[model samples]
Target: MSRRGYARADRPGRPATASAGSAPNTVYPARRSARACEGAAVGADIVIIGAGFAGAATAFHLARLGRTDVLIIEREASAGVHSSGRNAAIIREHADDAAEQALLHAGANVLRRGELAAFDRRGLFIVGPGQDEAARYCPRASGRGTWHPDDGTIDVSGLLGRYLEGQRVLYGVTVLDWTHGAHGLTVRTTEGDVDCRLLVNAAGPWAGEVGKLPLTPYNRHLMVSTPMPWVDGRWPVIWDGYRHFYFRPESGGLLFSCCDETPGRPGVYEEDPKILDTLQQRIETLQPALGAIAIRTTWVGQRTFAPDRRFVIGFDPRDERVFHVAGLGGHGVTASYAIGLRAAEIITGKLDGRDDPFGAGRLF
Candidate 1:
């Protein structure tokens, strides 16, 4: 790979150091040791693995609900090591799944309300065939589609910081294995064993492996063009809903994706350059008025989902102590706040999710 390739590759897939102006590093207390069977090196009432959107958002809500005895373990040195950090950071509420859409609406509302900083609220336009209703919102848009007045791009890192604010997270701690006991559970990690009454598997792309679930991770690519002077940064995100392609003004240019999905393993993504050709072909066929695009950089990211493509958020049937908040697919950012709130409610016994569309029972 070339120098630029190394830089872009580090963006979405590889586990690299936090970028400048990203989350600041925090010092964790020294690790303590305890008897293997009798106790644990660390202890908490709840232990969540993976400090990505799922884990951070859940912890945030748990704190909001007055539950402070929580601990988050992250394999990477910082949060959003994988998909959470690599995503395009667009907040779109429309979805084919009613359940997912509900969460998207709730979560996107929170983001759009200025609860967090670094949001470009230019709005979004989903242009497609027979989207007369959508066209009403973005009449100035070049094509007909639904207009999402609140939809726009966000500074993902800054948003992540808000979710992790005042949260107790231990970075660089990898969960090796865990054993559940009559009393609670003991999680074995690279740092040491952590004992907790409840465990959450929100490891994003690695959630399937961490929680022993059957979640699948798909690789997708994103490209940013060199500075396009004619591009209007205030323009809404223009997306071809039916064609699975979208683009928005970014850094004086445009960022786009073909919405390609290919099965992939956790943390292992190989950028397929051929996809650029596909993107070009789609752009030419769908909307060529913008003229030729000079690409600057490209990267690949992962999106995990269940076989049914619905979210998995409930206790594992095999073990009540283990809860899952995985499989948000590419909607993790847009749905994080709602997901965390709902997961916190269910985890705290305030809600029974066995019948919920996103419940883990459906997976069994």
Candidate 2:
């Protein structure tokens, strides 16, 4: 519904053990002044940077908890303009580790149970051409409890639209700087400044540049096709284990992804033309029937990853008032709710180091 506020009685607990006397690692020189804008001066209990799934979910969880003084700052003209909107939108119960698996399962349940909203479950299929790749996707498939020959796809656009409807989002506003002090955090944005006691850095790909955080970037790509009903809309979300290619149904057409990982600088990145050839070859090997499908349009997006691929959630190591909720890579859509709840719990002191494996200490 609306943006969430902070709890009156239950403020954030004592700063975590690791946050004491720590300072953020500065990278570049800070801008000298704030930007001019028009708006009533607003203050929030929590200020989240980024309007992607991670930030939106955090705002939703906070509202559900009856904490309403939350504001989300997004750089784009609308929400989900980047990775959140660019993804294949497949919800999977599979994870690489116990902690992540739990979050994945929990998020999948939220989608299936209609907690986020009514979502169509076409089911996810991890097609493996050989034994090694099968072994890799098997645990995740087994954990999901459903495996089918057809490709599974989720309605990502529908889910995001539903979740964000009627919510107060400051679109086209970019957070330029933030300072955490004894009083709380003061963030400067492209529009104006927001003063809040708690801050969540749910800024997906640009998380590393958002207020001096320790986040790494990874490269990924996705492509869309012309409307083709012949390609079974019910095709299970296909992952060519051998070629690292994946595809899912979007609207009536098919959306394919080349699971390409490359070294690069972080920011909104465009796709390389060579990736199209790579995707075509992979699709030919994995699903021969769809090889003939024409590629109507294509684009690329960065999938930011942490050092361990597990999410980095919890208070900032250097600043207790600043929180980190990022590094979802391709799992942001699947793990959004769980991660948001966990971040809110940490912010409100409902959860501590003992409750989450994604604590900031992991980065140490």
Candidate 3:
């Protein structure tokens, strides 16, 4: 991995040395052992760790379900500081496995239309000069796959903001450790401590380490090119079915991504030249007309997946008080709201469908 100057930090492997409060690095006083568990009976009702898309969406739905006393703790300075903000070329795919297809369907129902004013309906066109290998998202039809007008993009940060409405998020707070017992859950963070009735693990790539789930992190990189005045924002997202390379309009510029998933631990990822080279090769080979576009920026983020690559969304098999909403992989942005809704169902004991698909019990 080559070093580069870019940010968007999400995964939680870095040590928590900062302080609490509005000021950066302002550490709040740690609670005494007796005071830690002393709070509004059973702490904050709910304490969600990790304020990325998964956590934010869950918190949003939880609020919608009338459980607004949730406390979302984030290690980064703000929400979506990592994977949530880093991923731009997001789309919903109905053509996938049963679980993913279900998630896509549910997610579309929640985010595709209606009140999500931030929804961008540019559509997704999966082109093919080669094989439609990404057919799981869009199976081929005739010589090429048709445009998925139903697929769309969301301002991840903005979505996080919407989900965060009426919710309490403690920014710059890192949960150093937690205790889940019959009484309740007490989370000790770098900033301070909080007790909660239920603990939701939406920690993205760090869920396995933070909540004891068997999840693994894979690093992915995305590039944004210098503005191309001739590029049309009306142009739907174009993706090379075989190359795993996709690009979409970004403020008169373009956001590009390659299928570069390198297995790594949770931590800051140094820029990789090989992935950039892959992006370069993609442009030269397929969209030759956009050859003049130069990459202006790049950054890396992680996508955690379960052993089966499906999202883990139910209460921990070992403990009913612990719930999971992680292991989204690349389907996160597209299916986030749906996962959140599902997580809400699990938390509130109102699940309409079977939760076995993404249940943490599957890990064992």
Candidate 4:
């Protein structure tokens, strides 16, 4: 959990106050300080403003492409504290449009089959209490086995660890402002200023505030149960129809979610007890035998979306130097790798135009 540096708020290149009688226009010499500001105007190759899965995965891909000198800024004390950490860690198949689904399928394959050090496919299962829900996702099922034969849970922590190991991530640093000029871009953060040739706005819920781009917020909640071993059998990742409720086994117990989507502010949130109560009622109606399960912990997180629910990946239509990788809705975690790689490809000129259906042009 320890990041590369301390989270102290210290401006990197700002000159200290001049002596009381010093001339107002006196240029401060850059060589006198412990960290010289001489190269402050020289920005990085790529500057990413968020450190979640999208940002981290982008950094990883950029490094893989031999593009180092990339900087990532995060506002939280640690990475993945927002939507990336709060997600249920489900690697789902294409459940949306063709483009979105194709990217998701490609991303899932990278996690399961790629030689990258960051992914592992322990297998995933989507189960329903009745036949209707099961039939909906049946086409995407892996032939490895059925829910009855094997548990459907994925190793979410393992997946995150694989991507984050030995990476250069700046945590607890908030971006204040950024500007694109003819030469390059300038990014101002709580600690210091960064200059980069390319900029990516993968700030998640706060992406809109960082720039002129548009992003909307949506809320989702999840609940964990007190220790009980009864429901610990081969637990298939259960989806309660399209209702915002799903359950997975964890630590000799069950983790349930109402899958509720309510309009709300964007940030970390405590789970609504009423929503939990409602979810429990729904679960009981689906399976009355497990009605008395006790709740252990509950929490909520914002899922940002664009005007269209599809993801918006690629440069701003007006400014190609400023890339966008936001509005992932609830599918950010599932689509993180693909979005990151696609964003990198667009940045490096390996791809022509945004191939995903969730490209940024939809908003315009």
Candidate 5:
């Protein structure tokens, strides 16, 4: 699916360069020619770096608040090509942190409203040991669990489209560096330099480098099985909290993950073959009833996290003009709308998240 613009990259407004033959697992953004933005506007009231879920959703909320003159710069040729496009697309709002859970609830409500995209609402069944209530949610589940009839999947690309509609996004534009001074913030990119009153770093995996904050990007693997006639398409998503794995019906088959997290850098990801063995082991041990499953496709995506694991939103403590809408981690999909709304509220003075759980000050 095509995004409003190209995919976003890491290292927004930060001075960075990729060297030849860099580490295979760590990728860096390379500087591009300024010609990319030759005919586009070089100035805006707000310049947001990256067009993934964070940027798109923030732009969407800003427009709702009647704020225009926002320009989004993405390094990739399309949006959601990174983590936003690579998630499981599930909307389970059960988070260990209450602050994040609240955002997840708001975001899930946004999806169910049907304004952004189509939602499945197939429900979600979370299972763990000793609960003995798994059967309540999934008849096939053993042990204890809870059934959330509101949790389900969404059309991620379509949601991105809706959030980005009527927004000005410049794809294939790389942010070289940015500086904030008396004239406001000047962001230099491959397209050219743009002057803005505020600069938002929503560079996803690149957020750490872009905002100079403490964040790490971890890689996770997902696999889809070949179509199985016996597989039921209506089965609600089943997650095992103890086993650290989840699976749901997909395309007449099953899409599963072992929930493996490996620290890595940005850029392209090559599927790690070793994860297949890990997946098999987990499935055999935790979900053997499904029998042998043949994989049809596999992929790896990155999720960025703060040291505390809570989201890092609000303005940077070091630079108030440079705002942040990153560190959503894997919760980006489940909490995107609320994240954007919170960010917009903070930016427009409707609210201040600086001291809240999702605030950026805590990290400093």
Candidate 6:
């Protein structure tokens, strides 16, 4: 549950603070292992290894901190192909820890500041006899078992777009290998090679495979109904405390989740027909209108977690030049801003005294 240095928000040619590695701004004069160096050094001062929320957030913060010559790379053709893109898009500004509360609201603040706030302050409800644990989220309960007025929905895509517009990104770039050199690393990729002073492993589920971290992939499903004309699409999202089912309104219909989190590998996965059957069997009592409505479609996404269900952000124990920001089980979208800034701060050697609750040092 430790979060710390993920990127050294330093700009190109700036004296790097990395100890285990050096920032050799000079071009790689050495011959390429396969092809010759085309013209300019095909590398950046800092290379972000993933294009998901973590990568995008770090890129945005790094740019905000005035870092140029930085590159954000993604294996997918577009951003948010994994956890971020597939999130429920809820801005849950409810947590017990004061710092966590700040981080949660900061994410919502970024959305609102960027004009991407189409929120439902009516409240995020904790259904089915909410537990005492729910009391923290539902501070101002009107009548429900539990309700969080501060918890609202966000335009995740819009927020991401706002940050992505100013950064240099390369999509469809598959990172193949990393061979440590004199003072940095030569990253082998499907497209070509990139020599950089620093490398960030924000590769999400692939973090374990890429950076020697242990992460377990959990599969979750979401189903959308055709349309429930009678039901209000504006109603706040409902989450069952124990049943582990959740639903929110979207596009004239409701999106439902079995609250299913199954262990699996990263790839396209089929819908669990049993989850659909469960919804069909329980809809009568859950919501007659939603039950009456036919399910339009279903899909699956993977959420990754470490042994502890918290984020892993910081430098590699042995290699200071290499950093990681993965194992963000389900908090990727909710705490993207805070996590991103902290990671960038640590990497750039400007931590500004933030506590390291989710720091990777705890594991290393």
TM-scores of the candidates in the order shown = 0.86, 0.79, 0.81, 0.79, 0.87, 0.80
Best-fitting candidate, scored by TM-score = 5
Better lDDT candidate (2, 5):
5
The window of 10 residues in a row where model 4 has the poorest summed lDDT is: 21-30
Error of 2 at 184 (Å): 1.6
TM-score of 6: 0.80
**What lDDT does model 2 reach?**
0.65
List the pairs of residues colliding in candidate 3: 19-25, 19-26, 19-27, 20-26, 20-27, 43-195
TM-score of candidate 1 on Cα atoms, chains taken together: 0.86
Best by lDDT: 5
Residue 354 of model 4, lDDT score = 63
Displacement of residue 301 (Cα, Å) in model 2 is: 1.7
Window of ten residues with lowest summed lDDT in model 3 = 1-10
The segments of candidate 5 whose C-alpha lies over 4 angstroms from its true place after superposition are: 1-40, 129-141
* Model 3 lDDT per residue over 231-290, tens place: 676666766557677777766678788868888788667678687778878777766656
Candidate 3 segments whose C-alpha is farther than 4 A from its true place: 1-42, 128-143, 352-355
Q: Tens digit of lDDT per residue, candidate 5, span 1-364? A: 1222332223232222322222111112323335433455567899899888899899989989988778888888666768887788888887888889899988888888767788888888787634547556555555566677888988776777778776777777788888777879888887667799999999999999988999999988888888998777877899885678899887778888888888898755767878878888887888777778888778888989999888888988888889999888889987989999999989999996656778888887
Per-residue lDDT, model 5, residue 196, is 94
Tens-digit lDDT string for candidate 1 (150-262): 88877776677777776666666688889978799998987667789999999899999988888999998888888877887887788786888888877788888899999
List the candidate numbers ranked by lDDT, top first.
Answer: 5, 1, 3, 6, 2, 4
Q: Give me the displacement of residue 316 in model 3, in angstroms.
A: 0.9
Clashing pairs in 4: 43-195, 43-196, 44-195, 244-258, 244-259
Model 6 segments more than 4 A misplaced: 1-41, 95-102, 112-122, 128-143, 282-290, 352-355
